[model samples]
Target chain A: MSVLRKSTVALVAQRAGVSVASVSRVLNNLPASESIAAKVRKAAEELGYVPDAMARSLKVGRTEQIALAVADVGNPVYVTMMHAVSEVVREAGFRLVLSSTGNDPNDVVELLDNLERGYADGVILSPLRITDEIIARLTSTRLPVVVIGSLPQGVLLDNVRADSRTGVDIAVARLKATGRKHIAFVNGPVDTVPGSARLTGYLAAMESRGLPTTADMQVEASDFTYAAGLEAAQVLTAQATPDAILCANDLLAVAVMKVITSKGLRVPEDVAIVGMDNTDLADHANPSITSVDLGSAERAREAARLLLARIEDPSRPSETTVVSPWLAERESTAEGASRGKNVKARKPELEEGVS
Target chain B: MSVLRKSTVALVAQRAGVSVASVSRVLNNLPASESIAAKVRKAAEELGYVPDAMARSLKVGRTEQIALAVADVGNPVYVTMMHAVSEVVREAGFRLVLSSTGNDPNDVVELLDNLERGYADGVILSPLRITDEIIARLTSTRLPVVVIGSLPQGVLLDNVRADSRTGVDIAVARLKATGRKHIAFVNGPVDTVPGSARLTGYLAAMESRGLPTTADMQVEASDFTYAAGLEAAQVLTAQATPDAILCANDLLAVAVMKVITSKGLRVPEDVAIVGMDNTDLADHANPSITSVDLGSAERAREAARLLLARIEDPSRPSETTVVSPWLAERESTAEGASRGKNVKARKPELEEGVS
Candidate 1:
């Protein structure tokens, strides 16, 4: 009501050449005449009058609430992204509802299929695992969906992705500037979307720095989660402590920080750490953390914007947008007084072919 | 204290100058800083601290379970409530099921209606927006329902409400004891049950302290949400800076703290803050918020107990219970030497009549 300018029944009534009462009756399905209902429907469709905006405008958009399905709620990255998406969705006459979709690929398909029931007008999905079944569902699902992560070859949907090269470059540049040469890279499974891009980016970035990266210098966590990071970091630490370590993400960085500290080492003092996806986890971790800003929030915001655009006009070509990355330096790289205020998220650039 | 042999862990903890929990975590192969883990391991080796026990007691035999439908998962309050309810329910030979009912009143109705399909033996519902339709649903539903919130007068359904008096007293007492007088109150919509009770309690508490109150001293948020709190706090801060501010919940308090800090004012140093509901959000917030512990954990525990009791015997007279409250004094109240480890959660003592 405050931020969003919603299409009103009065406008629909005027367009349909019917009374406002008739529009209400038709909209609410309260036994309106067939002819009146048709006219009201046409008018509403033209104006994009959100159906039954009562109950919830009644906050954001009640009848037409947009749902954002994420992989995990525990991750601070999702929290930050949710906030950004919510702001954008609310600004455009839609309320954002959240559902933490399970990690199973079938779960993603089931969620998309549930959209057919019209529970939400559209969805902004961030799935951890992508399957062929999910792609097929997306192809058939009439519901406008804007994905905030990678989709495989030839699949057309509005997508927003983080430029992994920028993240790797940012992390490497920060570590190098801080005079740390013995840097190691921890990544997720190389077969996955982010894993492949990040690992490749790490390799290229290291090559640019003329740093020799033997196979031993690269540790692969089972996943991008803290639990996976913990198990992987134990393996990494058992080998030898590097002067600097680049984690796949903030959660992994936090795990590595924990593993390092529990081994009677100081963060930054002994082992400088640079994490990707500068999430609130980085901001709140003790001694904080310097992270490569993969701009999940901005990606989410753009995804939401893209979703709304397609909802308004569904024929728009599915364009892939790449959100740039930056460095959010903090205590984990070098213990410093400056805190909280330096966290950054970069804007998106329309990129070709998911690169 | 009863089953665990603390001497070994304590000895290691004292020798390592770290927490017993840290020592336990490191030894148990849970997530802990490597430095701390290494120190604890060294200490354990030096003291020859071998864990004294191996066998763990396991509870079994649950024929049925209760479902707890919470309003919002985004708020950490529901997580705390769920954990408490689960423990209580499990102890009673019943598993706890969880359903996140959206803010929509229809969602609440739909959730309650779904219970008719023989989902669970009972339900513990913590609804955000209570409607007359909801009241009717609660009255007519065949499923035993325990509400961890205020019910309308005379509609008794095993209601467990937070003792607003204790919460207000604890907040006011802590603020006053710390020499804050010019305290402002920020509340949610007064039409809501908790909002009404908290506002009345706040006003009455201020009067009891012989402190003058004015219309400007009270600000009403549209909802008990972070966004609403942010808007309400912007209004409050624009009016004037108070010596201290009391919020309806932890979310509002966090919002107010942000507003204060952004205005170049330091918490507790420039203005103290006290919030109701000692959720993990308060714990993780910067300059960690001191709050009136409304004992949501206790309320949920009672709610689970009530639901189970009603399920066991339908002839039992429905009762209302009031949970006691306390102050979780943190950095927001006073910049104290003791930090991080002093986080407390008070157990419930159910009193009568909601006062």
Candidate 2:
């Protein structure tokens, strides 16, 4: 017969010269005698006893396991968010399970089905796009789910979305302040949520700034890849070159920087650039790409918290939270024509006046 | 009583006007009448019925789920390898359960202990570092495990490792062939397995080429981060400037590229850069960094296969597989230093000498 080692609780009880019941009570933070608690603590320290959370969770019917299903795990922005989520989850005494669905709706459905098998107490989904069927399924699930993007109307669910409108507004405002009237918008896959949202945000921001939204100023990338960004830049620059360009993400911005430098165009002089997501790549990129922070970490934390809340109270009303985005001005947009003596400078005004 | 939806198989059988056994046999690809199979297939298609592999695995006393536990999920190289592993796992009709241990040995122990609950048929562990205690626990587990890196000597465990020596050798040879005699090595923490192996590989490669391996030529980074890489480059460049620099990973190489470019040093003309891992960052860098392909995808595929083999037959002898690295020459290398140029230049000398 295979022999199993004694558990830490048993060892603590033996070392403390106390009953196993008393040790258990003290360990579980239940009402116990002060003398017994002191003895158990000393014994645990001597024996180097560490409580097994998994076993405790099993008895409580709560695994303390949360699942995060993402469309593309290879993206650095998503990877950073996942890292932040893991840190928060670990600090909260929970385990995280990650699932990569590769930007496919069917794969997302399959991942949701797998999550429904009770492996995780709650789930955080970052689907590439939202559909009616997906929204309905999410609404009906018994487990807690926090989506990492915007959802359609009439389907109540916990959501944490990035305010790309504010992000694009800042980018456009900065560009206009830099005396850049002709600005271009480079986007990735309009069918995707971020792509569509960012595009709409750019258009609205440009219109609010009294800048003409022209067809020639908008360029859509084949995909959210560096190569696609490079190819899209070639097309965008072939026509009238804009004095400033706003990218949907940092990858495209980095690619544009490469192409612009190779073509002997000086950044912030010939053309300024701004990107979204503010990923580590942006900070490490040449010129240290100026980007907008979408509060990805905060969004991840909020989603995890919402999921945990719903897991604790399933009958609670679903909530949607929107995390704001901020501008991170770097070398890419440091000094432009407006900063020089060639353009007029505008005085500081109210935030509403700019937006 | 709560109402539950009918099983897909039952729905398919009802739609086909056939017995449920016939539908089950057809779904399982078992021997069945041609008419019955045709009816079942049509009915399943009409009802959009998809088989639940999880339920079947449970009935057969197997979960058909494999866990992949890594130290850091945010690392792009790991993410790339995970994509490949997921592809292989999904193709084999098995689900993947991913967990991040965050480079903590305690977390590693906890994750492994949790895996013993029989949720997954096997596990793939990519530990940041190997310790005796970890090795002991891994050896004691009945579940099949495939480690991504080296294991302790004489330990019977399957593993897949990258050939860092060959990678460094090829990088050094390419730089030397391009008339770059002075080379520098920028590495991450020497305590890490990859970091130490890469440092040793650089030293061995330099010695093989009869080049001086001076202390000033090697700069150890504080950690595997872009900031550390930037600081390491500053230290390396402060002493004597090397004609070529080899980095431990693509992220580090990108940092070096950014730093060197900012300092007015032209890549390939003033300094050539070569990085390990051949990640997407390398291809997207300003000069399209030259890197050594560590065969991460192949390694992941091999690890999955080894895990499946061990799961099928527990008594089989453990094996270790090493994947050879290859040089991916891009624009980052010196001009006219392509593989074609190297082969052509070497062929004439060999022919003349032999003749």
| Poorest lDDT segment (10 consecutive residues) of candidate 1 chain B | B54-63
State iRMS for model 2. 1.7
User: Which candidate tops lDDT?
Assistant: 2
lDDT tens readout by residue for model 2, A1-355: 0122235556777999976556655655545679988998889788876545422532244455788988777777887778877777666567788888776688777777766665677889998888777887787787788999988866689989899888999989988886677779999989989999999999999999998868888989988878889998988887656768899999899988888777777676567889899998788777788999999889999998777666544667989899999999988886622232212222233112322
lDDT of 1 by residue, A1-355 (tens): 4333334766787999977556655654545679988998898789876656631342233235577877766566887787788778766655565655656687678666654544467888898777788788887898888888878868899999888876897788777665556679989877767788899999998899987777777999998877798899899988854767899888888888878777876776667888888876676565678998888889998998888767755677898998999999887887332222111210121111111
TM-score, candidate number 2: 0.80
Reference interface contacts recovered per candidate: 0.00, 0.81
lDDT of 1: 0.74
Please identify model 2 stretches exceeding 4 Å from their true place.
A1-60, A336-355, B1-61, B336-355
In Å, residue B201's CA in model 2 sits off its true spot by: 1.5
**Taking the candidates in order, what DockQ does each have?**
0.04, 0.50
Q: What's model 1's lDDT at B253? A: 86
Instruction: For residue A301, give model 2's deviation from the true position in Å.
Output: 1.0
Query: Residue A253 CA error for candidate 1 (Å)?
Result: 2.8
